[model samples]
Target: MAQETANSQENSNDLGTITVEAEALSIVTEGTESYRAPLTSTATRLDLTPRETPQSVSAVTQAQIEDFNLDTINDALESTPGVTVERVETDRTYYSSRGFEISNLQVDGLRLPMPYNNVHGDIDTAVYDRIEVVRGATGLMSGSGNPAATVNFIRKRPTDSPQASVSGTLGSWDRRRLELDVSGPLDDEGRVRGRLVAAGLDTDSYLDRLHRERGVLYGVLEADLTDSTQLALGHTWQNNNTDSNMWGALPLYDSAGSPTNYDRSTSPAPDWSYWDGETHRSFVELTQRLSDNWSIKGTVTHLDMLSDTKLFYIGTVPDASTGRIPNSFYLSKFDRHLEQWVADIHAKGNIEAFGRTHQLVLGSDWSQSRVQQSSLYAAATEDLPPLDEWDGSYPEPEFGDPDFVHDVTFKERSLYSAGKLDLANRWTAVVGARLSWLDHVGEQYGSSQDTTLDNELTPYAGLIYDVTDQASLYASYTEIFNPQTATDRNGDFLDPIEGTSYEVGIKADVFDGGADAALALFRTEQNNVAQLVGNIGGRDVYEGADGITSEGVDVTLAGELTPGWQASVGYTYLEIEDAEGEATNTYIPRNMVRATTSYRPASLDALKVGARVRWQDDIERERDFDDSKTRQEAYALVDLMASYDINENLTASLNLNNVTDEKYLTSLKWDQGFYGAPRHVMANLTWRY
Candidate 1:
């Protein structure tokens, strides 16, 4: 039936161009039509276009990555509109969109489990061809989750032709890196192909006694088992080691509320403190073309993570003489392990029914994860440790004591289906739903029992209308439900969190060339959100107390507006409020803007120069008790890149970040203070064969 529908569509196209053609109206054929097709036609089976996807979607392609010299996943995503990246440590990072943290991550369209604050290593952008982002509630595709957004990393595939590349980089703070990528056919019949990527980096931080070393290895193999069957196997390994890692932000103000800045060279950790982490992932996928228009795919993945660290947290102590001013104390030691497994099956096909064409997708996902931690505390120390201790110049000291161990396990299962119907020549509609179940168990080595289960259903709907051949308008509504794993006073798990989002937008190929642009207005509401009322020592205890609402507008322009010159611009206007808390009407910035432009003046055949700027409006935060008292601030950053191609196979590039050397914070909190990164420069040389 699906094959018949596809044939009918092809037949209609042929007939319209021949027998039914009218001289009054001419069908315009653009040479670049194939280039403008949805991304699904490019190495993946998912049809996602900015205009047809029913949500705000953004794609960062390989050209953009190379133009910006993006080395990591976080670096590549920083240029995306409505997205923010914050580095917590050398190896840990956080991402948020529209005032909410994004938890849904996908590799090749398969959802991966994201435990609380867990960062996975399988998302390295160095081995990917592109990155796709879908904003707003993704329940139709992600099952149970927050209403933030979803990030999909598309891996690089082996081309029919053989290619290889090697790059070396040197940067500020004595940083050095080397990377290699190679791809070719593995069989004479061209039935088997493979690609391999590897990189190593060593760098020193601006802060005293801080340094890091990291490496990654990735490989993918594809085999055509038969005329209609294919299989792929992939593996990734990453290791990171850091000395004197920073955990908390630095203080931004003195006791009198006067602005204060810490020296960029200051280090919060003792010279003896260090952190080391290792991660490994293995994945396999099978694809079968059951028919011309119907296909099924299955995937399985496993992940392992381990970390060992000695951390220090600064504390205040009373002075012996004045008894007013306070001295400082530090607490430090820890080991952690995380393991996960995920499996999924997906089926997609096309059907003709109700006098229209419909695209249907059905899938099921199963995931399991386990997390364990063991921590030790250090006794009070009066004597300071020497900075050179980290370099093996000083003897080690025993300052800590042993502590207890904790373990937690999380399990999730989901079933979902979605469909898009082409109702008319210019109208389309999409509807979908998901059913999910989750279970959690927390056990203390010698404590009481804890276990719980949660289940929920989520739904989505959207509509799109083509106002013209070059423009389209769309509206969508989506919802999400996330289960809570924390136990209540009665030792019972809390109910799941729920949220909904509404969005309307217009998308256009403005120049009728390869250029694309979009403008969207969105509003989201979250209910039963957890809020912290008090703290048990250093840990925060939260209860489901209040609701929150956010409204925003997002604008983006990308691709080539003209030949030899390319530009990308993004802007967001947002309003966030606490609907049910004492701190209502608190505004979260509301304005953000970013722009990038590159030009190759034709006269300079081998030279290309680019510049980018980002700005954000002031964010106002008021005290819960005294609404009149507040803090407000804004920031802007600039970066530049230039590259020279010596030949078809050789290129050299230079990058300058924070060109103005501005001192500003990326994130701030009253309790944790402020976090920021300093100005830096990096240079790279690449050779391709």
Candidate 2:
């Protein structure tokens, strides 16, 4: 997992009979020096290029990351098509794709459910070689849940030769960042290799009194026990501390159900409010070559995350005449810790039957996670000072004993298998199924409850037909099941929610095979979805929905457009409806486009310039308090960058974001909302060897 093992580095646009004697090492795109990668294993268990895979897949390569300065996961996802990053608060976020939440994330094919808050603070990209997103039901590889999308983060590995680089950046709002990366052979025989990556950032925000500090580190070592066997160990750590963290966003409506006009920098946090987070992960992997056509890889990983927060909350619309809002105000302090362990083992190989070769993959995985938390709360001593008069100059609450405690554990195990067979001339079939067992047991808020489910099966099927040497037509169907904690009217747990996805499309190797293009029509159907039935014993009961649907169209093009030029562009149109045929999740935009392009002229080979544009249609969220919807109009943002090689080893670049200074709310998912970032600029310099 930390060294390259293959026949050799293959060109990105080349396509032919695909074989994988190099699966032991996986695919590495570190030094490819291209905006596009040639191979990926995230869409399917087999090693195939984006075009060869029967799904809508997208990749952000190392070159694109560096050139675009996408230093954080949020920054990268914002550039991906058919995806949405909702910043509901200062430190918490939610990601949605194809009208559903992305519930899990993977690293090198190892899966972990999303953290308690989905995402917090920052996830540095320095440790990753590339990030791949498989849009649609990836149940064939990922066990269950979320028919939206699957994200795979490929970690960087040691290089066959010594390499070193250092970089520094200064940006708007007193932002400063430094990063380092180095990799090399650890022994004279080149049988051992190592890589190290680290980054540090300190920054203030466009919001008043908000500040953040972050640090990250990643390390990996690989050793070859035998010529055909290898072992690798790796660990990663990151810490984030924020001052004046906003627990909740600003109020959107006033006493008269009219919108409130607050400056973009307006904040709801007190002077002493804070949020801090830490994450630690360690992994070990072993790969063995059973034969020239067969190989096995086993992996074990542990993840731990901690968050300590003390914050404030405000609710209800303010009164217009009294100068004092009748809203409820409160303060609370809580600390949470979560831990997870995951293990996976798999074997893949090729076989000959009927004078043709076919690929088969078999694997099993198990995972367990537990979360513990304690909280302290106090209602505001009095109504919060008038909204317009408040300046965060208020008395601190004298907190009492623990208000609540939570301890819960969840476990899931599954066995999955898939095969790619040559059905006939210019035809191929991909089919697979997974059987999973899941359970949740523990005391949550002092309530002891246990739930379990077994023998849940998910199936996957797909077919591809070669329309021409440069084009292919394909269709696929996939299913995923999500276990439920919700109870029925009889106090019995309901069955798992089921999601089935269908897609048909055409993919082509265009621009003389230097690029790839695809157009897909996709639809998803969900049943047994939870819905509010009625209140029983002063508690709301839920019943399954008959059916819910989401359908959309997607078009994308990516790769080298010409000599010294690269581009990636995507567009999407989506609609979601419930059993009654009424629109659902209206907050999700129906139309979106993400495009970026860079050019390095032949006359000025040492200089590069690029631009990016992101646009989305109008979206709205219903406000029960106002009896209306808080609507945000369509908006578009543009960014530009340029870099110049000062010498053989030094390079300088500058990036300007939100060139139009578009002003809009970050989200309206909740009754409260906040504004997005304003215009900003970042300058960076690097030295490499």
**Which candidate achieves the best TM-score against the true structure?**
2
* lDDT tens digits, residue span 393-455, model 1: 222346455577778787888888877788889998877877888776776554433444445
Instruction: Find the candidate with the highest lDDT and give its number.
Output: 2
lDDT score, residue 272, model 1?
71
- The residue pairs found clashing in candidate 1 are none
Query: What TM-score do all the candidates reach, one by one?
Result: 0.86, 0.95
Model 2 ranges off by over 4 Å:
2-25, 115-117, 321-327, 382-390, 443-449, 534-541
Clashes of 2: 0
For all candidates in order, the CA lDDT equals 0.67, 0.82
Task: Give the TM-score comparing model 1 with the true structure, all chains together.
Answer: 0.86
For residues 130-189, what per-residue lDDT tens digits would candidate 2 score against the true structure? 888888888777777778888888888777677789999999999999999988778887
Model 1 misplaced stretches (Cα beyond 4 Å): 1-46, 89-91, 118-124, 316-330, 383-402, 443-455, 485-492, 530-546, 581-588, 620-632, 673-675
Error of 1 at 469 (Å): 1.2
